[model samples]
Every structure is written in structure tokens, then in C-alpha cells.
Target: MTDETDVLEELASLPTLAHPTASPDGERIALYYDITGRNQLHVLDVESGSLTRWSDGEVPRAVKESPHWSADGERVYFHKDDDGDEQHDLHSITADGETEAVVTLDGQTTLFDVGDDGDTLAIGSTAAGQQNLYVHRRSTGETERITDHERAAHSGVLPPACDRVAYASNERDDSGNQDTYFVGVDGTDQRRLDVGEPGAETVPVDWGPDGRRLLLSDTSTGLNRCGVYDTTHDEVRWLGDGDSQERPVAFTPDGDRVLAVRTRAAADASVVYDLETGERRELGVPEGVSPFVRFGNPVLDDRRVLVLHTTPTRRLELLCYDLETDEYETLIEAEYGDLDPDRFRDAEFFTVESDGVAETPARAIDLSPATELDIECLLYDSGERPSPLIVNPHGGPPVQEKRSFDLYTQFLLTRGYSVLQMNYRGSAGRGRAFREELYGDWGGAEQADVARTAEHVIETRDWIDEDRIGVYGGSYGGYSAYWQLVQYPDLYDAGIAFVGVSDLADMYENTMPHFKTGLMERYLGTPDENPERYDARSPVTHAENLDAPLLIVHGVNDRRVPVSQARIMRDRLTELGYQPGEDGDFEYHELGAEGHGSSDIDQKKRTFRLLGEFLDRRLGRPVAASGRGDKQ
Candidate 1:
């Protein structure tokens, strides 16, 4: 008999499998796993519970993803960087364990779709400076460019008919707007589908079974809306208009109905929608315990819809919900048992008064133990009162914080701490106007919103130790943490920035070749037009205002926000008479083999452990290294 401790240890050591793709016949599934620091593709027999690895034993240099099954289900195609240039090439491997390269390109290539005939493959390549769609004939080894554009083309789809390909391109409008278009296999009959407004971005999500209609998820109104466009008539019609987002997952095999995923007003649960009767249903393993129920572009057979569902206590398994019987059957289950479900939360939106007259609808997650609240405070207390509070500003000043299962938040909560995830004015999901609010004012108004959110938590929540408050974030979030040290010197007791950009000028000059063009214009303003904005927002210029103890973590291979950003900030802080690892000062850690974010499990674990220790040291709490592990 196995011991209880041994069982628990075995469960903890279980590995996770991700990116599941079903074969054309829906009898087999292919997935990737990082069992021991190497990614390997595995194929599982649906009926036999037998598995086989396709990648032999040697790990690919870069990550392997986007597994696409061929028409016959005998071969699987994927993209990986065999060389060190960061460009991915298309490769195909058969179920019998034979591997071969399908096509090679000069620049990065993403596998879009394999044609229904298995003779043609659609791919996106950046061979001509900008990303465009291409059709490569496996027989001739000749490539044909489909879309010619300056911006980029994304979300490419090829119908089962195999005559034409549909994709979204930002060609017509130069304002970073995208629209759906289609082209023939021979590069003839290139025409843009009328997807309503030009300012709105439309992506072709899926093709109907008959290949006569296309389902599109449009973001024209700043919210996701579904529309069906008839290819023959070139007309579009919306399914519904609500302040929510809708995604078309799959079309019924008969092409009579569409399966869609819908998010409610506050963006909590993802529900399913029926196109024919306008009926909505929530799919899950019952409802009480927050089962992780997600639709993965629904796998439709002739008889049923195969929906993927799981939870924190359930492994990724497929359930076949019959159309007639409405009964469900488990089709496939991961070899591992009991997985963590991706947490989903509703956005609590409220207007916060800023600059006296300006009121912005600020969104945030409470994470407070007490729900009964009549006052507005940044800190709160429960039975275990007076715990340390960490104000976490999300990266992508343009990206808003959403309610999802986050490992970081769970880890902090387990260590007797409360985390406040704030979605400032510049965050996405609210609308275009809110997202553009940070265009020219990076550290000015946006920074003010961050301060206001923290203040709100402190004043209304009485259980928080206000003096022990800490700030932490990465990327743009990291910039916000550093700005907090300068804009409001006494706001946080300590600040921890991970792979953050401290100098705007250095970020503009040092980012990857592809990101430099937009980074210079979006956050730091144009180098020629607004040099003052660049100088003003640079955190290095205001480094002297940093009085709190600080810790900086960066990955040497980080191309988004390069390592130099952290090195420059550390040097300046040292110049200001601060010593490394000294008490009440600053510390730096440069992860050797990591990128913008630490992907290595050991590195992530160590980083979080160090972060918790630093926070405990500053907040006067007990420092314990043991806690909940990685979420993924």
C-alpha cells in the first residue's frame, strides 16, 4: 500500500499537458508536455489510453506549438525554430514516427492552416518586412503571396472546400485597424469582405461546415461581437448587440447552428450560445464549485459537440455532449490527476474622482477578506487582521487586469498577505477611449490613477498595515512600480520590479527590431515629435526620489524590455550611494537563461521565494519559503 505522504508527493510531481489538438476523424489527440525541462509532443489513442512521443528525445531549441493535423489524420504539422534566429519553420511528422520539413522561409513563419486536399498549406511569413499570408504548395515547393500590406495580417482561416483562404489584414486602414478578406488558392479573385465599419477590427474566427458562410468576431465597438458573413452575397449581420464579448467556437457539422462562447457584463463566466434558437447554456461539471469549463473551438462530429472541461481538481478531459440526448461522456482525460483551474473573476467597476473634476471608471479586484464594506479604503483586515498589502499594477498599461486564476495572487494569499490588482484608466477591456487615455501621458495621469487606487484601498479597508504596503510589477507594470517610488515617495514601503523598463530612451533604442517602431510612438512618443515626453516619463530621470528599499529582477534574454534597462537603473541607484543587497536599499538579480518573463520553473520558484522574503522583511512578517507552487 502507498503511504499518504508518498501519494501527495506523487500528485505534486504530476506534469501538465497543454495545446490539445484533435485529429480530423476525432479519434486521436496530439499535445505537448514539459515533463522534465524539455517540450515533447505526444499522441494519445482516444479509445486505448495508449500514448507515444513524436519528438524522439532531443528537445527543440525554441518552443514548439500550433499543432495542425493533416486532412488524412495520418500526419501532424507544427512550427519550431530549428536555428537560433527566432524564425519558425513548418515541420511535419507522421504517426509512425517519421519527421520531415514541409516548407522553409527566410523570416518567421506561423502555420496558419493545412488545405483540405493536403496539397496546399497556408502560412503567414514576414519575408517582405510586414507579415502577410502565403500559400505554399507541398508538391511544387512554390509559394504564392496572398495579401500585400504594410501593417500585418493575422487570424488566417482556410475553409474545408480548400478553394479560398480568409484572413484579417490591416491594409486598408493605417490606423492599426484590421478587417477580414479572402483570396483564391491561385492568388486570383482577391477581394475584401464587407465587415461593416472600417475603424473596427474584424477577425475570421471559423468557417461554416458548408464553406458558404464565415463567422467573425469583431471588436468595432470596443467589445467582442459576433457576425456571420455570406461569402456569396458579401453581407454581414450581427447575432446580438450587448456590452459583452462573444467568440464563435465552432459551426455544427451540418452548418445549421453555431457554437459560441459569451462573456457577461462584468466578464466572469464564459457561456455558450446557440445560433439557431438563440439559447444560452453554461457547460461544466455541475456549477457550485467553479469547474474550469472552457470551449476550445468546439470539436464537432456528425452526432455531438466535444467540449473540453476541467477544474482545479480535474485534469483536461473532453466531454461529448450529445445534441439529441443532451447526455455527456468523458472522451479523453490527462494522464495527470487534479489540475488547477484557470481562475475567473468579475471586474468590479467604479468611478474614482481624480484631479477633482475628472472621474474615471476604475476597475479592480478586491481580494479583501471582508465583503461588507461601506467605506473606501486601500487596506482592509479580516480575522487575521493587519496583514501586509501588495499593490500589483498589471503590465501593458494598455491592458487591463482581468479576473482569472492567478498563481501569484494565490501564493501571496497562502503566505498571509492580501494582493490588490488595479486596472488603471489606460487598461484595455473598458473601451478604446479608456485605452487611449495613456497615449501622451504615461507617468502623469496614469500614475495618478495608480496612486488613487492604492489610496482608496487604504482609506476604506482598515485591516491593512498602510506603512508596510509594497509595490510590485513587471514590464510596463515594473515601470509603474518605479514611477510610484518617484511620484509618491512614501506610498509604498518597498518596490520589486521584474524585467521592467526604467529608461524610456533606452527601451526605445534597445528593443527588438520589430517592436522599436511602435514602442517609440506609443509609450514614449515619437523621437522627432515629442522628445520632452520621452525625457519626462523616463524613470531614470526621477530615480533620486526613490527612498524605499527596492529589488530588481531581469532576464538576460529579454528582448521586449532588454536587460540594459535594469542594468542602467541599477548603476544609477548605485551612483546615488545605494549598495547591492544592503539593508534598506536595492538588490538586483539577472537570470542567465530566461527571457522577459522567467519560463523556467526553478527560476520562477526562486524568484517568488526571494520576493516573498523581501516583502516579509519589510513588512515585519515571518519569512517562509514553502508555499503553493506554479500555477501552470
Candidate 2:
């Protein structure tokens, strides 16, 4: 206990690594790390323990993100935006750490896809609020705007043999309708490949390692179906669809089969799909695993794939799955840094009475009014005789709470607080219909499920106190916290909303163009068609119902749910006589040099410590004094 660091300290000191890209030769792995308080590109000698910084300290404040290695292993490409400005430009750093601009256009240009030969780069060229695909060549130092799509256009992969790039665009109709398109590498032969149905999204996954096919995942049939686009016939063939969502992990080197991840209910399974007979063979997942595929990446050799596996008894570990013998080997250590894996608890996935899945280390309780549908709820043990409980509502309506490591949940769990995560209606991995439950009724059905989840946790858990229950979430989850606290005040003790939406109407009108059109317009319909519906679901309309302590934190540069929402929320709270600060029920913070969420470690540490302090004081429970395990 004396040797263990607090949750805030751990979260602050630990480095977050992402976007791991390997060189074409598979000798080096380029990863973006936030170890220096900001994201920086670092190259790892995969065979050795040597780590080298790929970029010099020229762009200190610029978040060095999206590190992709050149096929020749000579250069690394990345994008950087200064001072949180959206004016991103593409830059390439050589093997010797010398960086130079690659594509400097009028508007922001981001490197989307780089070809195998390392000469051609697919760039998302944005100007005057519209983005289009551009092909940039290093050999000729020439750039060509390919699609000329008036709407947003994003590309994925370019086959080594074919002179065409796979992309998705909504050029004609911008009702958030996105479908796959292929255009020539030199701005010719533009053609639409798939006529996906409305509300269907077809995204280009990646180019085949053998250059024989292009992998794609289509949601036209309502479930993400993994398929391949044959370069020989230029025809698309589907492997599987419906029921569980199938995501293509990687294609075999010979192009004879593909590794696909199938999510069935709350659990995940790895399968190998045959390209010839279309036969699928289910592979063995890790032993004692709760069956959530945390990490899976195909090694360049196609002999073994790296996967992150978690079990109810252990934390996550990178395992190498060999395709030939079907054996697994530990690739990375089970422990992170010097942190002990035994001290952590893995979430247990459960099916509620209404078929909803809830995940937590806590005991799950079923809550359903006599007339209402039952909802799943997790109850974590606080270890104390009586303890404070925090209800966690996840973002993404269709994102399920699975058996995996949740950093925030772990942080709160170690602080002697029980956290409840709800897998409400519309959460994915179940099926098409189950995930589509909140299509036009986002605030209606999901809110009921969240309320039921919280109520069940407090009413059934013996250690949880009803008056100390709180809700916290970010983005979509942020909306859940704000909406739940405002509409059903008596049900929650306090609320902390991070980059959340307070008013659906305001969100629909003020969000960024693509998000406003893509997500909100499709999720809740346009305000022009459903003004009353938007108002009915808005938490601001029922401001009089808010009586709990509320804290709102938002990044000022957030374009998804603008900072204005937080300002408006604070205005409403002040108008309702809730003062700001230590004694008040309302508090707000707007962080600069940040986006919706951030990769800045200092800011994250500051925000997390503030959260702990607020919860400890509000719930009347100081977490620093608690060291006992709260596993249920």
C-alpha cells in the first residue's frame, strides 16, 4: 500500500502509445507517444530495446500525430497543427531526424494514405470548409486534386499494382451518405464502385499485402460486413454479414485467406475467412479470456498476428497468434511499466434480464420498472462499509461496455468508489436491430436505460449510498451525464460532463459541418424536420429539474460539441440561482490548446486530480486513505 502510487499519479506518469506503424521491411515500428507531455514520434527497433526520437524539438507545441513509415524505411510522415489550430499541414521526417514540409496547400492538408513504394501519398485537402482527395508525389514534387468532390473525401489504401486509390465520399448528396469510390493515382478514372443503401457506410479498409485485393467493411446491410474488392475482376465479394459485426483484421500474404474479427453479443471471436471457398474457420482465442479483442495487428510476414487479450482474472497482454500452428505467444509484458497486474480487476460481462450486457468488476444488478423494460447495471464493491458510487455512461450509442481495461473505471475503483457502466439500448456488437434502437430517439430510450442502470446499482448494492451517486462521461457519454442529471435530478447526486452536449438543438445547429450533417442529422434528424423532438430531448428545456452539483469541462477548440454549449449550460445554471465554486452546485472549465479531448499529459493530470478532489469532497470520502481491493 505504501509503495503504490495514487490513480492520478499513475495516469499522469504513464505514457500513452498509439498509431503503431511498421516499416515495409518489418524491421522497425513507429509509434506516437505522449511521454513528453505531448505527442511525439518515436521509432522502436522492434528487434532491440533501443528507442530513438524521430523528430527534433522544432515543433514543441504542435501535437506530432499520425506517424507512418515509408516503405523504403527512410522517412516518416506526420501531421501537425500549431496551438490547437485546425490548420494542419503534412510534414515528412527523414531517417536522420530532419523534417520538411511535404504538402503545403491553401487550407489544411493531412496525410491520409501512403503507398507501398513510398513515393505516392494520399492527402485530404481541405479548403473553405470542404475537403477533397489529392494525390501527392515525392518523385515529381507534383500534386493533383483527384476527386474534386464538393463534400468531404477521405482515402484509405492504394494498391501497389493498381494506379487507383480506394476512398469514400458523399459528393452528390450530403445527407451523410458515404460510399466507396476509386480514382486514378494521377487524377483520372474517377468512378463510384458501390451503390450502398441510405444510412449505409462503406469504408475502404486496406490494400492486400499481395496487391490482389482491397479490403472493405460495409454497413449497407445494417451490420458491418467484411469483404474484399478483387483487383483482377474489379468485383466486390462479401464473406459474411448480419448477426454479429465482422471486421477484417488483415489479409494473408498469399491472399488466400483473411483474418476477420467477429463480435457476437458482448464477446469477440477471431476467424479466418477463406478467399476461395468463402469458408470460415473459427480460431482459438486466448485461454481464460473474457473474449474482447483488445489488440490485433498482422505482422508484415503474415506468419503471426499481434493481439491484445484480456481475461476476467487478468489485465491486457499482447499475444502473438501464429496462423500456421494456431498457437499463441506473449509478445509484450502483461504488466504496464512497473504497475502490478494483480492489483487491477477485469470487468465481467453479463446479460441483463432485457438482454442488455453490462461490464464491470462490480456485481451486476437488474433494474426494470414493472411496466418498463429491464436494464443491466454493474455494481462495484467500495470495500468500505458504505461507499460512494459513480455511474459511468459510455459515449457512442452503439459502443458496448466489454470485458477490458477502462482507465477511468480503474482510477475510480482504486479510489474506493464503485463505478457502474451501462450497455444500454443501441449499443453495438449485439446485432443490427439491437443497435438501431436509438435511431430517432437518442435521449428517450438511452436515458431511460441509464437511469435504470444507476437506480439498480444504488437500490441493490449494499455498500453503495443513494445520495452519493454521480455520473461522468465525455462526448456522447458527456451528453448522458448532463442529460441524466438535469432531467432526473433526484436520481443523481452530482454530474461531471466533459465535452458533452446540453442542448440537442444547439448541438445540431452549431457542430462542425461534417459532424452536424453526418452524425446529428442522421441520429436525431434535422432540426427543420424535428424541432419539437430536439427540444423534447434537450436537457436545457428541463433546467428546473437540475438540483444536483454539476461540473462542466470542455475544450474551447472543440468543434463537435462547441464550447458555447458549456457557456449556455453555465448561463442557465446561474440564472437558476446556482452559484459557481466550492460552495456552489455549478462549476465550469474551458481549457485552451486542447481539442474535444487531448493527448497532453499535463492537462490530463490536472483535470483528473481535480476530478478526484471534487468527488472526494462532494461524496465525503477521501480516496487517499483507502488501499483495500474493491473487486466484487
Candidate 3:
């Protein structure tokens, strides 16, 4: 039998590699690696296949964003914050391990694009209160504000000429709707593109080789579509058939075709479309693995491109694909230590009837316009008959739960528990109507979908222990755990909410300006405009209904969801006569020196161990031999 230390070490010690970017010459790749517990910069040589750590020493902070290579490939630029506060400051490191702070700004700062000549950097920052675009000159050491918008705006892409930039902003109309705009580096000749409709999302993806044509992705027609906007003609040409969801990823090396990813049933495939002939050809990528095209230019050459591939059981691995040979070479493999890769479990896909379509929708506040709702879910079995189950609802009420790998899910499986993940309404990968169903309904239909799906899986699968079911998640998922336990008190035996939102109105007030305007207003309107809806949807309003054992974990420095969210829930539970201690059912764990999530390996291991201990004590751990299947 494996001890707790061995299980935690094996499950939580897997190293990760992310944000792979090819150098300008396409000879080297820069990526962020967490092999030293926290993320750091690493350079991978394409020809030699040797990886070298560029950042020196171990620091408390890790690289927060993708590293950008200089035009000459001598210096790589990245950003880091103070213990995940998200107030990123730009830094540049040379090949010899010399590092210097390039641009230091207040609030959150993002390095959007670096000029081809290595003279300018287009960035978006919240230093002036709201996110705005700016241009930093390398030679003169000067930074100029390019836009003075009242709302948040992000720099999208800077053309090769380095004279202007394309950005996305919601300053024109509703905060929920975003449109693309072009502005000169000197803050002149600013105009919006007539590419997207009102109340639709449009953003620039990449620039063509000629610098006159800009690639765009929009949701004007209720599904993602790629288009090319010509600055000279002031016209747009759409690509692909208007049936399935597709988004432009990058322009091909020669600019003769557009490389895009098409989504179907929550899985993605890479396809290239000929600009002149309108012909589409799908790349022969491996089946069941999602290819992640890095932002900006990912096309290394005419015959080769770089993509990060992932699956349900494996972590992200960088790959170099050859278009001519239809073969891929793994550049960086995810380190799994001495454990067998086959020990991890794969997901089984299932489609459950939406709770709204059922005879009686449980806890649904109002009926949405969606008539037929088919909720997609992934179930990871622990190989034990009658296993304890964890129902994990993903965050980003708008984000979809793809067949991707998750360390937390794998950790749960290692502890003799099955995992059920649902892509509830408002999840992406589905069409517009499905995502819009949860727009104004927050904890209503989506919560109902989760409950119904969990109930359905419990009823159909004899291997799942209905009495040992738990609901857990982080971010919006954390909110779902709170909402699920309160709304459907009898459904869950235990619950864990990590950095979750308990009060909707409070979250709107305390969150960043971009989150408030871009997400909250778009989802449920403003607190003043719809105060009752905010109160009605919040979990704190119904905290009295919570009867299950609940564990609340949050980071003190979390700016996204805020640690106050957990504090309020703990206070409420206390007011309702519940105590928090080793002898108590309600518990709260606050992590210091961390933000929305932790990057330190020790913290991750501690949290995993705590969760396992909590659940084991609450819902007795399954015996290795007969298992919980014999209970029923």
C-alpha cells in the first residue's frame, strides 16, 4: 500500500512546461518551466535538442507570461509579479544569465508584441486605473501612452513595420461587447474596424506578411469565424463554412494561407485555408490530442510549425511538426519522474440531458431560451468498483472542460476516487446559444446542470458511491461548490471551495476593472442595474441551507476572487451555529504569499494532502480490496 507521502509526491511532483515561443530565426524556443517548484525561464535549442536554464538562482516569484525573443534573438523578455499579485513588471534576460528590469509599471502590465527591429514594445497596462495601450522605445528609454480610453483595452498585435498596433476595446458601446481598433504608435489616426457587429466579440489574431491585412476572429454570427481585414480596401473576407466554430490562430509562414483551429464536441483540430482559392486542408495531427497554437507567430517555417499537444491523461508537451512528412518530434516532454505514464487514467465522454430540459428543473431560477440542451461531461474512473467521486465544475462559466489533463483530477484518482467534470451551459466549444444560456443566470441553470449531471452519473454508474459524493472547484468553480451545497443540500456529502466567490455583488466591487466591466457586467449586468439578481444568485444569501461538511481554502493575495470571499462564507457558517476546528465539520485554510493559485510545489503538495485528509476523515477512504462498491 502506498503511504500518504508517496501518493502526494507521485501525483503533485509532475513538472510542467508552458508558453512555448520560437525565436525570430526559428532556431531556438523559449518556454516557462516549473522544474524548480516555481516557473522560470528556459531556452531550448532546436538543432542540438539541449535545454538550458537562462534565469539564475531561485526566486520567490516566477515568470508570469510567455517569454518574448528579441529580433536578434540575443535577449528574451518576460514579466514577473510579487508573489502572484498580478502586478507584472517587464524584465529582459540575456543568454549569459544577465537580467534587468525593462519596464516597470503599476497594476497589471502585459507585453503584447515586440517590434521586429527590436526598438519598440507594444504593451497594455492598468497603471492609469484602466487598461490602456502604450509603446516603449528601446533606444530612447521612453514610453508613450497610445490610447486614453475610459474602459479596459488590450494591445492585440503589432505589425512588422512597427508603426502602428491593433488592439481590442469595449469603449465604443456596451462593456460586454468588444471591437478591434488600430492606432499609430504616436497616438494618431485611431479608428475602429467595421469587422464585428454590435454586441459581438472581435479581436485581432495576427498580421499578414504584407502588413496591410490583419487576421481577426469574431463571434458576430453566434459562432467563431476567422476573417481578414484589408486596411487599404476597408473590407473583410470571411474564411471557412459558416457551420462550425473556427478561430484564426496564426498566418502561415508565406502568408498565402490562414492557419486556424476548428472546434467540434469540445475537441480541436488544426486546419489551414488557402486565401485565394478558399480551400481547407486539415493537418494530420495526432488524434485525441488538442494542439495549442502559441500566440503571435507560431509558424516556424513553410514546412515546420510548433504546437503544444495535450490529452486527458498527459500534461502539455511542446512539439515541432513537419508538414511534408506528417510527423512530429517532441521538443519538451512533461516530466513524470519514475511513475509509469500508463498509471494515469483516461476520460470517458458522456452526454447528459440538461436539467432545464428535464421534467422538473431542480433549483433553476428561470428558463433560458435554449430549447434543447445536451451537456457534455468527462468521467475518470479510479479502477475501483464503487468509488468515492468528486464532482468538479470548471471555472470560467464561459470556459469549456475539454479532454485535457489536470493535475488535481489525477491526484484525486490516485487517492482512490473517481472524478466527474461537466461542461455546463455557458461553456465554450459549444455554439453561442449554449454559452449565452448562463449569461444572466449565474448560479441558476448552470448549477442545475451540474446537479442533474452528477445525479445522472450516480444513477447510471454502479461503480460510483452516491453516499460519498463531493463537489469541489476553484475560482468560479469554487462558487459552484458553495452554490451546489446550499441549493441542493442533500446531494453532496462534503464540499471544498478554493478561491471561490460567495457574494456576487462583493466580487464585482472588489475585482479588477477589467473583470468587473468585461465579465461581471457582461454576465449579470451591474449591481445597481440588477441588484436583486446579484443577491438572488449569490451563495451567501442561502448559506443557511448548507448542511454538508465544507472546507474553504483561499490565497490571501488573491486579487481575482479575493480572500474575503472565503472569509464571508466562514463567518456566515459560524453565525449559523457551525464551528471550525479539527472536531468541526466546517474548516477554512488561508494560504499566505500566494495569489489566485500557487506555483510553489510545497504549497501544492500541502493542499493536496490537506484535501485528502479532509475527505478521508469525512467520507471514509475506500478499502483497497473490496472497495466502496460493496456498500451499495
Clashes of 3: 0
Which candidate leads in lDDT?
Answer: 3
Which has the better lDDT: candidate 1, or candidate 3?
A: 3
* C-alpha TM-score for every candidate: 0.80, 0.86, 0.95
lDDT tens digits by residue: candidate 1, 1-632: 43322333333344545566667776777766655544677776766757778776433433434578887888888775633234667888886678888778876687777777888888888777667889988778888888776656767788988898998875652343567888887778888877757766688877887788898878777766778888788887677655565666666667766666554322333344566776666554332212122212345365466555543234445555666665777755544434333321222334455441112221221111211112111221212356567878889765545444344554555455667776666676555555555666667666666776777777776877676788889989999888777667767788889888788878877775345543456545555677777777778877887878888998787767888999999999989888778464888888766666743344546666677667666655622322322111
Off by over 4 Å in 3: 57-63, 355-370, 625-632
Model 3, range 320-430, lDDT digits (tens) per residue?
A: 888778788988887888777798899999898875532333342444544457899999999866688999999987788877778899888878889999899888888
Question: Which residue pairs collide, candidate 3?
Answer: none
Candidate 2 C-alpha lDDT tens digits along 1-632 = 23224546765556665556666676666766656656677776656746677765544343434566666889887776655555577777876878888878775676777787778888787654667888888898988887776557875467875488888877544354678888888778888775456656777877787676788877777777887887678788888645567877667667777777777544566778878888887767654422322221245456665555665435555455677898876544443556665656555444345322222111112222322333444444546556778888888765776655666677777677777886787776654555666677767656767776776666666667666788898888998888787656667778889988888888877776556655776678888989988887777766767777788898887766888888888888889877898677777888887767765667767677767767765666633345432321
lDDT of 1: 0.64
Q: Evaluated with TM-score, which candidate comes out highest?
A: 3
What lDDT does candidate 1 reach at residue 476? 90
Worst-scoring 10-residue span by lDDT in model 2: 357-366
In Å, residue 182's CA in model 3 sits off its true spot by 0.8
